[model samples]
Target: MKRQRAFFHTLRLPRFRRITLPLLLLLVFTATSYSLVGRQTATVPLPGLVMIDAGHGGYDPGVMSNGILEKDITLAIAKQLQAALQARGIPTAMTRDSDIDYADSGTKGSSSKRSDLNKRLELTEIQQATVFVSLHINNSTLATRGGAEVFYSEQNEGTAELAAAVQSELHKIPQMSKRDAKPGKYYLLRNQEIPSLIVECGYLNIADERARLNTADYQKKLAEAIANGLDSWLQKNK
Candidate 1:
């Protein structure tokens, strides 16, 4: 009887030791992992919402040349831009998703245009956007003049930086013309309280540019470049 009791006691101690050691190790590992995860989460910055405005729609076709309508092109590029930004975890809102304008009922001529623009401006505040980007297609009498240009309002301190960032990325495109970001007295940019800029994707009067802008592939490239530029600016400013 004494021998049997001693044998059982020896086995019990070994079993207890084995279970207790592993449990303690597990607790330590779990605590370490949580600490690392917390640190990573705290270091990452949150991005702000961007307001994208497709320049013209509905009755307002903006500048048209070479069988291309400005309203159509703007909406296409805007949608692509929204997708690209969202894919990178950036929040975005569009002024108009369809071929429609914001003008109120019975509004006509210049009044309609003003009403439409005012409504678009109101969205920036409504969406609580940190930045505003207006997409447009340029037209010049000289057919030779082509390429994307970025314009910013001098009223806002950060507008120039945002424009420069986007302009730099657009310049990297093989088919895009290299142009410096400039200040503009545009209605949208002038009234914006936040950082606002207009990106003239390309000249519609230019044959080659018009053809490329009409294609889905080129529009995607433009959207991607704009997205990269916005991402770059956000990272630095955030």
Candidate 2:
């Protein structure tokens, strides 16, 4: 019994734990480091970078109707879209991740908006992005219009195809009425340097549509649709 007690006491020594703890930590660290290194080496590079623009942030709340602000909705969708793309190993860059605009607050509102847009244009150029998607919610004095629409610049090559690809997936959403992708002369789209599109996710003027757009579940669906469209288009082009 004394021998057994002595052995058990030896097992409980502080020195034993100090030695064993370091060994255990070393083993864990080695395994984790190896796994991370393997993953980094194995991961494939994306076909190209994608630029995501969340429309009308900061001072520009965009189209506001009822209680819904278009800026909030666009930002929410843009965040989700960015996550969805990143999860698929695609690289993405965002113009504004927060409520603030890209331009200095001291500037006049019109100049601020222009400056914000110019900053976005600069980012697209600097990154040499393969394509740019701008998220927006539509509104009108007439409260009856509601649907997902994609707008592309006629001057930009492959924008029509990009718009069509995204619109097709968005149409799958039951709440969204099918609308054809159309030519738009919007400032964002008219940049012919790269393929660019403005996606009007839904009409905020319509009560039902506004409520749906405000929901997280619906925002996720919209993000997924956009991601799918982008993946399809990119794969085909590759």
The lDDT leader among the candidates is 1
Question: For model 2, what is the C-alpha lDDT against the true structure?
Answer: 0.74
The sequence of per-residue lDDT tens digits that candidate 1 reaches over residues 1-238 is: 1111000000011111234677757654653211221221111112367788998887789999866899999999999998888777777778777787877778789888898898888756755577899999999886576889999999887778888999999998887878889999999988999889899999988888999999999999999999999888877877
Question: Model 2: runs farther than 4 Å from truth?
Answer: 1-46
Please identify model 1 stretches exceeding 4 Å from their true place. Answer: 1-47
> All candidates: CA RMSD in angstroms?
19.8, 16.6
What does candidate 2's lDDT look like per residue over 59-110, in tens digits?
6799898778899999899989988887765667776676766665567767
lDDT for position 80 in model 1: 95
lDDT of each: 0.78, 0.74
Clashing pairs in 1: none
Model 2 is weakest, by summed lDDT over 10 consecutive residues, at 2-11
